[model samples]
Target chain A: MRDKNLNSKLKNNFGAKANDSRIYIFLVIVFVIIAAIYPAFFTSGSIKALVSTSLIYIIVGVGFTYVMIGGNFDLSIGSIINAGAVVTMGEFNRFYKIFGGVEGGDSALIKAWILAFACAIGVGLLIGFVNGFLVAKVKVHSFIVTIGMLTTVAGFVYTYSHGNSISANTYSLVDVIDKSFVKIPYLEVFTPRFVIAIILVVVFEFILLKTKWGYDLFMVGSNKESSFFAGINTVKKVWITFIISGFTAALGGSLFAVSMNAAVPNFGERGIAPLMFVLAATIIGGTAMLGGSGSVVKTAVATIVIQSIFSFLISMGMGFDAQVLAAGVVLGAVVFFESFSVYRQGLKEGERPALVLEAEQLRLKK
Target chain B: MSSDNSASVVTLKSNTGKVSFNTIANRFGVFLMIAVLLVVGAFASPRFFSGANWLNILSAVSILGMVAVGVSFVIYCGKYGDMSVPMVMALSGVISVEFMRYGIVPSFLGAVAVGAVIGLINGIVIGKLKVNAIIWTLAMNFILEGLIRWSYHGTQIYPDMATAVTYKTGFLLPLMAKLDPNIMNIDLTMRAENFNALAQTYFAGGIPLMLVVMVIIMIIGYFIQSKSSYGNKLKVVGSNYDVGNMSGIRATTIVMLAFMISSICASFAGVFITSVNKVGAFYVGAGYDFQAVTAIILGGMSLSGGRGNIIGVAGGVIMLGLITNILNLFGVGTFTQKMISGAIFIVVVAVNANSLRKLGKDDA
Candidate 1:
C-alpha cells in the first residue's frame, strides 16, 4: 500500500504525460455514456456528421496546441484559414485559366489541386513565419503580434474577396474531400479529411513527445530564461512553433475551402470565432495555458468529445443558443478549475506556477 | 513611477548630457505618427484636414475611445482584456433601451448597474480565483452573448414607440418633459430624431459631449494609474500579485475595481451604440473588444501590465480614427482601407516593439 501510494504520487506530480491517460479514460466514459443514452449516436450517419463538423476545428486545434505548448498564441489561425481558402481559389482560378478553364480535363484538375494546395500552405507558412519573427525577434508580445497579423490578414482577405463568398465549386476539390477511404457499418465512414486529421495527430504528437526540438520548445515555454541558460535556442524554438501552427491552420483552411467548394470568409475573416474555439478546445483538452505541457492526440480526441457533447445536447432538443451557452459555461468552468488546481498544487509545492514566479522576479527587480 | 521615470531621464542626461532625436522619435512614435497622419491628410485631400471633418472623426471614434480607455484600466492592472465587452455592450444596451420607458437617466443607470454586476463576476472569478483572464472572460462573453440571443430569439430589439411611457418622478418630471419630448422621451416616434440631433449637438466647438466624456475618462484613468496610491497598488498587483499580496495591498479589490470601472464605461458606450443604431442585438459591438485592444497596444500600453500611458492610448485611438478618415478621404474602397489600416497597425506596433527592445525593455 505504501509503495502504491508513492508510485501514484510520482506518476501524477512530475510528468506532463500523466494526464494523457486520464483524458483518454474520460473520452471512453464520454463515449460510453453518450452511446448508452443516445444509441442513435452509434449510427454511421450521426458519427460521420459529427466527425465532419469537428474535423476542421480539430485540425486547426492540433496546430494551435503546438503553439500553446510552446507558451504562445497564434490568434490569426482563423484568418490564415480564411486566407488559405481565398488563396486556394485564387490560385486555382489563375492556374485553371492557364491550364484550360472549361475543358481543363483531369490533368488540369490535378494540376490546380496540387498547385493550389501548395500555394495555400505556402501563404500560411509565410504568415506564420512573419508572426514568429515579430514576436521572437522584434520582442513583441505574441498576443498583439498575432492580433496585428489577424487584422492585416483579415483586411487582405476581405479586400481580395470583396466581402463576398468566393465559390470554387468548379475546382472539384469539395467532391474529393469527402471521399470515404474506409467504411464502418452502423458506426461511421472514414473520409479523406478525417484520415488526414488523424494522421496529423499521430505524426505531430510523436514529434511533440519524442523529438529533441519538441523538448526544447517546451523548455522555452516552461521557462524561457532557464532554457536560455541551458543553451537552448529559445528564440528559434518559439519561432518554429508559430510556423507549425501556421502550416496546420493553413492546411485546415484550404481543406475547408475545398470541402465547401467556396471561400465562405465573411463570417471568419476576423478570425475571432475560430480563435475562441481553438483556445477553448485546447484548454478543455488539458493543455496548460502556462505551457510546458500538451498533447496533439488528446486535443484531437477532446475536440471530437466536445462535438459529441454538443450533439448530445442537440439530441436533447437544445437550441443553438444552448450549445453556445454550454460551450461558454464548460470553458469557464474548466479554466476556473484548472487555475484552482494549479493554485492548490502550488501551495503543496511551496512555490507558485512559473507564470507568477517569473513575473514576481521580473517585476520586483524594477 | 513618475520619480522612477524622471530618474531615468536624469541618468540618461548624466550619461550623455543630451538627448538623441532618434530616441525621442522612437519613444514618442505614436505622437509622431499622429503628426505624420495630419500632414499626410493635408497633402492627400482637400477635405481631409477641415475642422468639421476632424469633429466627424472625433465623434466617430468616441464610442471606441470610451471602450479603449475603459479596457486600459484592466490592462493597467495587468489583466488580459475583458472579452465580454461586446456582449456586455449588447446586453446592456438592450437592457437600457428596454427600460427607456423610464427616463433616460434611469435607463442608463439600470444598464450600468447590470454592467457592473458582470464586471464584479469577472473580478471574483479572475481576481479571487486566479483563472486565466483571457479564456475566462472569453467564456463569459460567449455565455452571455448566447443567453441574450437565445432569450431574444436571435432578433434585434427595436425601440417600440407604442410601449414608450415617460416614468414621471417628482420635480424632475417637468425638467425631463421639457428636455425630452424632442427625443421621443415618451415614445419611439421622436427617439431617432432626438438621437440624431443630440448626436449633432456639440458641447464644445468641434468636440461633442461624448468626446468630453472620453477626455474625462482618460484624465481619470491616468490619474488613477499614476497619481493615486490605489493606482500604485494596482501597478504592484499587476506587476506581480504574490509580491503585491506580501506587500499588503488589497490586490483583489484593486482588480475588481478595474473590471468594474471598465464595465461601467462599457454600459455608457452600449447605450450610445444602441441609440445610434436604434436597436439592440447580440451582434452589436462585435469587433470593439479587439479594436479597443489594438488601440491600447498602439497607444503604448504594454500587455504585461503595470506599464502604459492613457494619454498615449488616447493618441492611439485618434491615430486609428485618422487612419480610417484619411483612407476614406483618399477615396479608398472599404476593402482596401481595412487592409491599409491593418498594415499600419502591424507596422506601427512592430516599430514600437523594436524601439522598446532597443531600449533594453523586452516583451518576449
Candidate 2:
C-alpha cells in the first residue's frame, strides 16, 4: 500500500510539473527555429529590443492569466491601458504647467513622476472595481460588461485628450523610471521595465502557487457551485483577479508611455492585438480557456515566444498588418493543437467507454 | 433540502405562466422605448418626425438589421455571437463587386457562396472540433481581414459599369425603386446615377428597398427559428448541451446550421451595403459586429441563448437606428454617442439579467 501510494504521488507530481515545463520546451523549440532562420536574432541588440517590447505583454499576460484561470475575461484591459497611459501623460502635463521650466531640478521631476504613476494605477483600480461590481453583483456577463467598459473608457480617454496624443517635454520625469541598469556590452537596453515585469511574474507565480487564495481561485474556476459549497467566497476571489489584471495592464501601459515619451489617446487603438497577445500567451503557457488551470511563469515564457515570433517577422520586413495575421495564425494553431491534445487525453482516460456506451444506447433506442 | 425542492417546484409552476408574460414584456418593452424616444425626438427636433427622416433611419439600419438577424440565429443556438460577421461582410461585399464581370446573378451567388464556405469552416472548427466559439471566430476574423487587405492591397474598389449593369437588372432594383415614375430611373447606366436612383428609390408609402429586404429576411429567419425542426433542436441544444445530445439532437449539426444561416444573412447585408455605398472596401463592414451584438442583446435575446426571436432582433436593430438618429439630431459627437450607446448597452443587459433571474430561467 505504501509503495502504491508513493508511486501514484510521484506520477501526480510529474504530471503537474510537466504541464508547465511543456510550454517551456515549446518556447525553446520556437527560439531555436527563429535563431536558425535569422542568425541576427541572437544579437544582443535584437535580444534587448525584443525583451523591452515583450516585457509589457508579459506583465499584462501574467495578470490576464489570473482572470482567465478564474473563468472570466478582462477585455477592458486594452482600454485600461489607454486610460492609464493617457491619464499619466495628462498628469505629467499638469505637473509641467505647475512647475513650469524646472530646468533640470530633480525634486520637481520626481514629484511629477510620482503623481503620474499614482493617477494611472488609481484609474486602473477604479475601473477594475466597477468591472467586478457589475459582473459579480449585477450578474452581468463579464464579456459584455468589459466590452462596454472598453468602449466607454476609450471614449473617456479620447474625450479627455481631445482625441490627440499628449507629448511631454519633461523627459527628465519619465527618464527616472525609464532608465536602464547594468549595461552589458552590445545588449545595452532599458532594463527598468524588464525588471518590473520579472518582479511581477515572480510575485504572481508565488501567489498563484503557494497561497490558499490561489487554490481558491482555481477551485472557483473549475466549479463555482463546489467552491461555494466549500465556503469559498468565489465572487470576492473573482473580483480580486479583475483588480489585479487591471492594475497590471495599467502599470504596463504607463510604463510604455514613459518609454515612448508620448501617450496617444488611440495608443490602444489596436484594441484586440494586446488582448490577443495576452490570451495567446496565457493559452500557449498551457492555461485552459475553460478555466481552473494556468501558470504565471508559463505565461511569461509564452509571451516571450509570441514576442519572438513578431520580432522575427519584423526582421523579415513584414508590416504591422502581416504581423497581426501571423499572430492570429499562431494563436489559432496553438489553441487547435492544445484542444486536440486535451481531447485525445480525455479519450485515453477511459472516456471512450462512456462515449461508446452512450452511442450504443442511442443505437438501441433507434 | 425538502424546502428547497418545494421552492423550486413553486418557482417552476409560476415560471411556465411567466414565460409568455416575460416574452411579451420583453418584446413590448423595446417598442415602448422606441415610442418614448420617438416622442422625445419629436419634441426635441421638428425634423425627427418627418417621413423622410423616418425613412432615413429605416434605410440606415437595414444592413444592420440583416446582420443582426444572422447574429440572432447564432445566439439562438447558444453560440454567444459571431465575431467573424464584420469580416464576412467586408469579404462578401468585396467579392460581389470583384466578380461583377460574371454578371449580377453570379456575383451575388458567388458572394453568398464565399460566405457559406467561411461559415462551414467556422462551424466545423467550432462545432465538430468543439473549439471555443469566440476565439476561433476572432481568429477567422483576423485571417479574413488580412486576406481581404492583401488581395486589395489596402485599396477601395468603386463600382463600375459592370456593377451598374448588375444592379440595373438585379431583382432588388424593382423592389427598391419608388413607385413614382420620376423617382424610379432604372435606365441610368452611369454608376453615380444608378446608385442615386437606387438610394432614392422606395416602395409605396416610402418604404426603402433594403427595409423590404430586411423584413423578408426577418420573416424567413423567424420561420427557421420558430417553425422548423432545426430551430426546435437548436433551442434544445442551446438550453442544455448534454440534454440535447442525450435526446439525439445532433447538437453539432444544428450549431453549424445556425452559423451558416448567420453567414448567409451577413453576406446578403454586405451586398446591400456595397450597393448603398457604391464602393467595396475592406473597412466597409468595420464595427458592424459589435453593433449587431448590441442590437441582438437589446432586442431581448440573452447572450446565453435559447430565448428571443427574429422579431425581437428586428426591434433591436430599429432601436439602435432610432438611438443614433436621436443622438445625431441632438448634435452629439460620434465619441459621445459611442459612450452613451455603451452605457445603454450595459443598462439593458443588467435589466435583462435581472428579469431573467426573476423569471427563474437558467442561463445555459
Top lDDT prediction, candidate number: 2
Q: Summing lDDT over every window of 10 consecutive residues in candidate 1 chain A, give the lowest-scoring window.
A: A264-273
True contacts kept of 1: 0.71
Residue B152's lDDT in candidate 1 = 58
Give residue A357's lDDT in candidate 1 (0 to 100): 50
For residues A235-301, what per-residue lDDT tens digits would candidate 1 score against the true structure?
Answer: 8888888998899998999888888888866654222267666777788788888988888887887
Cα lDDT tens digits, model 1, B68-134, are: 9889989888886887899899888877765565656777787899899999999888888777677
**Whole-model alpha-carbon lDDT for candidate 2:** 0.79
Question: DockQ, in order, for the candidates?
Answer: 0.51, 0.40
Q: Write the residue-wise lDDT of candidate 2 on B1-364 in tens digits.
A: 9755754665686666754555565667787888888898987798888889988898899999899999888888778778889889988887776555435666679889989998998898888878878778877887777666555445566665433332323322333333433324333345344433444567899898889988999999999898998889988988788799899888888899889988999999888788787777666787787788899988888777788888878888999999999899988888788778888887887778766665567532
* Superposition error at A307 for model 2 (Å): 1.3
